[model samples]
Target: MPLSEHEQRMLEQMERALYAEDPKFATALEGSGLRVHTRRRVYQAVAGFLVGIALLMTGMVAKQILVGVVGFLVMLGCAVLAVTGWRKAGKPGEAQAQPSAGSGSRRQGRRKRSVMNRIEDRWQRRRDEQQ
Candidate 1:
């Protein structure tokens, strides 16, 4: 769904505020170049997983429990890295931008609200009172 006019205006205002507060960060975020980094991470993870498998097989043949355990741990870490990289890479730009843009929005309906959410709430309440 598209943002309503009011929401769009609010978003614009928030963006301006962000830029004003930290121009350096705002500029740094432009043209993030994340895709290449993500791809590299994925490749590294795959390589690590393959190496771990080889180590695991060698340990099993040698009957070295410590080596096998280390190999298992390495495999687990590599699997986690690959999964996270894939997940992040698959997300659209909007989904990634939303959280950073509106750090105020409740996350997955969690009970603990972010500081920005509280600030926005206060601002809203003040606006309502003035009206």
Candidate 2:
């Protein structure tokens, strides 16, 4: 459900007042909840990876094949989780700044032309300098 207009206005006013009262504190708290949650997940995955490593080493010293296999699987799963979480977390403002679906191809076209134009300009400059 969406907030009523009056509630939104009140919330905005409170945010503004908080910023005015302590800009630094407000900035420190500005990270989105999703970003924080994903970061926490990544951290947990890393810790789990470390635990897996310890388990693998213990299994090796004890000559236990099953324990070693389980440890390897745990490490692999944690690594995958860490990678996915990191990808999802991206830069804090990246999701907010993304272009809409309709504009993606158009933006890519402009980017390609700009890159080609730069290369052409560099080639022309090199030719002129060699003359």
Candidate 3:
């Protein structure tokens, strides 16, 4: 159902009250609307999951059992992850990995690459160059 103007105004007033009471909570809630990093990923995952279902259904009807089964499994995995996210309580918006504070926008994926992997990549590049 669509909310009326009065209802939206009331919600806005409530949101202001919430912001005044707890800025953190308000920030979190507001972050939810335009949280490009997290929400977009979740929305993409959900869309991919639904598309997988459609593919599975098409495969099943077309007698392509393997494709159907693969699609179904992929869909099931996404569903399980969506239902149980990283948190058991199913808070999907929260990042599974938090970035370090005050690191600017680079905080999201700042894991240190392993020294071994870096060495291996260097060796591989050298081999490719020689080849």
Which of 1 and 3 is the better model by TM-score? 1
Q: Give, for candidate 2, the lowest lDDT window spanning 10 residues.
A: 95-104
RMSD of each: 8.2, 15.5, 16.7
Residues 60-80, candidate 2, lDDT per residue (tens digit)?
Answer: 999998888888888999999
> Candidate 2 — what's its lDDT?
0.80
Tens-digit lDDT track of model 1 for 1-131: 33434677998898899899999997677544686688689889999999999889889999998888888989999999999998676554433443343346556434343455676667778878999
Candidate 3 residue-wise lDDT at 119 = 60
List candidate 3 stretches off by more than 4 Å: 1-35, 84-131
Candidates arranged by lDDT, highest first: 2, 1, 3
Instruction: Please report the candidate that would top TM-score against the real structure.
Output: 1
TM-score of each: 0.53, 0.51, 0.37
Estimate candidate 3's alpha-carbon lDDT, on a 0 to 1 scale: 0.64
TM-score of decoy 2:
0.51
- The runs of at least 3 residues in candidate 1 whose Cα sits more than 4 Å from the true structure, single-residue gaps closed, are 1-32, 91-131
Error of 2 at 126 (Å): 52
> Model 3: per-residue lDDT, tens digit, 1-131?
23434555898899889989999977777554444554455665677689889989989899999989888887887776565442332344563332243355554423333343466567767877999
